[model samples]
Target: MKRQFVTTENTLRFLEGFSALEKRGAEEACLMVVDGVPGLGKTSIIEWWAGQTGSVFLRAKKEWKPNWLLSELIEALGQVPRHGFEKRFKQATEILANKHEQFSMDRRPFAVVIDEIDHISNSEKMLETLRDLSDTLELPFIFVGMGKVRTRLTKFPQIASRVGQYVQFQDVSLDDVLAMAKNLCEVPIKRDLIEFLHRASRRKMREIKEGLSSIERFGAINPGKEIGLDEMAGKLLLNDRITGKPILVTADGFGGDNE
Candidate 1:
């Protein structure tokens, strides 16, 4: 399989939401929440976005406190963390403010991405610290989490009200699966095979990628032949997300022993 990032519908929606957040009138309202189920590619797309846009990306730890978050933010901004929590917080905000100014002068979008933010979503102190930073610097802060983040944030109306946008990533569609196959698969795959993989993987990006790899492996031996569902019958595509057993392609469709 080719190493590539395919642009799916979710990715486009994320970009649109980010753009809207950046252009919002109330500068203090700079928080954006991105939530989705597991294996929907939220972290993958956010990491890719950070790399491409020179944004700061950090993953929230389960034990994260205000001080720890400040320290990580300071480091991500390419500075040594200060000795005290207050000093670290000041240093991080200064660096972020400077970077935000530079990005503005260059007309580039800049923001901080906190992946796995559900870890800290319930901590009022941590969420208050995040809100303070955004309110102080008027900078965008993206909080990426699983489906619970949005519901959990309701407890903190001060933080939730500051959310400029809420982007929920959905499962990939058949068209998205076909696009991934065309962009990431090295072999020519028939529509039937792609459809089977889509259904078998339940339209999850990670599972689809695994299925694509299986097809690529089969293509490696077949050389230039176009692969169809028949050619992939009885081959292991991916493991069942629920059953933890290998899902194989059948002549009729796909199923695992447990299913």
Candidate 2:
């Protein structure tokens, strides 16, 4: 079973561009910024790419102190000589440069996915450091952030200038959601059912997936049987009881859709 939300074309373009840069030369690691509303699956898309391309992925979190970000990178690259951020980044870069000698392709094609970058990207210093790394070392880097991120990034012209690719994740379309449901949930859906849920979900993947999950739960109770509209209407979180309509389930971030 395909346990993934389908990769949209805009996403595929970014992935292909990243690969093209890496395969061509040292300059391939130019900065990429992925901006989306919360729960749009930016991290999932990047991690999936990492698995396919052998790129190193680092997730930056809310509690991650500024220095810790650099420290972790240093440690991961086998170059943590000391605790200071600048020292560690310097040593790591040197070692990576050394390892990229004539004998082998650079393993340092590493992509540091700075998760939640919007938290610190507005900080002038941090943005400059990332910009410097991308400019000087030409490191492969990605910044993952929420809706306000792209707007925030525009504040720093220097950093914005280095961005080779920018991606804005739109909500999942109806066709894609239905396809993922039929293929991933092992449920052959009818057109009416698809329309019913699409109206309720506005085509968000998380919402549609959860609805399918509800369907699976229904099937679990009535084993080896199809979960038709009646069962869905009663047990599913989608239906509006009083009006007899499917209630729109809004995504309150974290990628899950809710009624």
Candidate 3:
């Protein structure tokens, strides 16, 4: 199976939200929040967008202090890290301001995406810094966190109000499953197999990848044959949630036991 990024419904929704927020202009709040359940490809979508737009991507960590965050932002903007928290913060802003100035000439927009924001969602200082940067730079600051991000932001009403767009990702639909299979699978997969894989993986992108890989392996072992649930009925396609290992449930080993 080939590894690739498939544009599902979630991707389109994210683009729409971004376009809407961008249209709101710098006069309004330019912050965007993308909160979704784990394993729903939120990071993937953000990374893709950042790559396309030449945006800076930062991953927040639990141990990140104010200085650390500022330094990261500075480095992401391709500036030399300076000493002192105030200087570093100012340097980061300066870099962004210069970029914004250049953007004015070319009529291009710049954005920054901070992923795993839930790690420091409780840090008032960090959130305040983000708000200040968004206001000062007047550039789009996208926050990517888990499902509770919107609820968590309520603690900072000022920041929450500035959220021009908030996108909540949901589980994959049947069409998403089909699209994923078609993109990853090299051979023609039967509809019944696609349905079975979708349900078995619970529509999670991570598990769906695993299930498709398993199917690919099965197909490789048995070439020139249509893959189906019967080939996988006695084997494990996904891992056990708790143990992180394969869990196979077969009927008495195909009735080999004494009856």
The backbone clash count of each candidate, in order, is 0, 0, 0
lDDT of 2 by residue, 2-114 (tens): 47557665467567766665664436337777877754557777778766655556776566665776777676666546767777667766764554442136443456567
Which pairs in model 3 have colliding backbones? none
Report how far off residue 233 is in candidate 1 (Å).
1.1
Error of 3 at 140 (Å): 0.8
lDDT of 1 by residue, 67-116 (tens): 98999888888889999988988898889999999999999999999999
Clashes of 2: 0
> What is residue 188's positional error in candidate 3, in angstroms?
2.6
Better of 1 and 2 by lDDT: 1
Model 3 per-residue lDDT tens digits across residues 1-259: 8868789989998999988988885454899999887877889888988887788899999998889999988988887899998899889888988887787678765788999999988989989988888898778899999988999999889888899999888887779989987888876667667776666565677777877787788788788877765555676666744457664423332321111
The TM-score between candidate 1 and the true structure equals 0.96
RMSD of each: 1.8, 5.9, 4.6
In model 3, where do residues sit more than 4 Å from their true spots?
A: 103-109, 242-259
Error of 3 at 259 (Å): 34
